[model samples]
Target: MGASSNEAEEINDWELPNGEENKKIEEPQETTEVCARMDALGKLSSLIRNWEQNDVLTAVAVVGAVTTMAMAYSCF
Candidate 1:
């Protein structure tokens, strides 16, 4: 289910009208800034996930310790 050779040739031969091609292209600095922002967002998301996991684990440990202490005291 792909385009025929003649159709592909026709598509490849297409061109933008007048001076529109120059307007469509992005500046290199803008592209780099976008990429850097994406990377920073990715890193921030990862850090938050890890911090949440650590907090959950810490809570579980505290609960377990409290339960153990209560059981020990009840044995008196």
Candidate 2:
């Protein structure tokens, strides 16, 4: 005894019977952090914001990058 052909065709219903397939992913409440990295990033953000207010931070950043690059090339 086997399922009739009609029973096989009915299994192809387009939706799950109660919308179970439409569920969304939920955000997790906890996350891992590196305290040192977080602190450095916070300080950097503060410096940028202070620069925005005082108007010399961008120039300082450019100088800082040039200085770092010069030092790196000198080392090699």
Candidate 3:
């Protein structure tokens, strides 16, 4: 079964039920760390929090490409 035109349009727009619009909640910004190492660690933590599956796939692709290049170079 296929969705009707109205239903398809709603899905594309990501509209909520009852014609409600999405709202963004403001978050408090974090204070900057005085120490460089602490700031780096904080950024790393943030990266971990926002990590996604695509990042893992890209890392794997990089490793595979490097390995292939090394193997090809060794044949010279």
Model 1 segments more than 4 A misplaced? 1-51
Q: Per-residue CA lDDT of candidate 3, range 1-76, in tens?
A: 8999998877676646878666567997655654766889899999877978999789899999999999999999
**lDDT per residue (tens digit) for residues 1-76 in model 2:** 9978888766553446785554457996543467677888999998877665347866888899999999999999
lDDT of 2: 0.75
TM-score of 3: 0.41
Order by TM-score, highest first: 3, 1, 2
* Model 1 lDDT at residue 52: 72
Best model per TM-score: 3
What C-alpha lDDT values do all the predictions have? 0.82, 0.75, 0.83
Give a tens-digit lDDT track for model 1, residues 27-59: 656688899999999998987777777797998
Off by over 4 Å in 3: 1-34
Worst 10 residues of 3 by lDDT: 28-37
**Residue 7 in candidate 3 has what lDDT?**
89
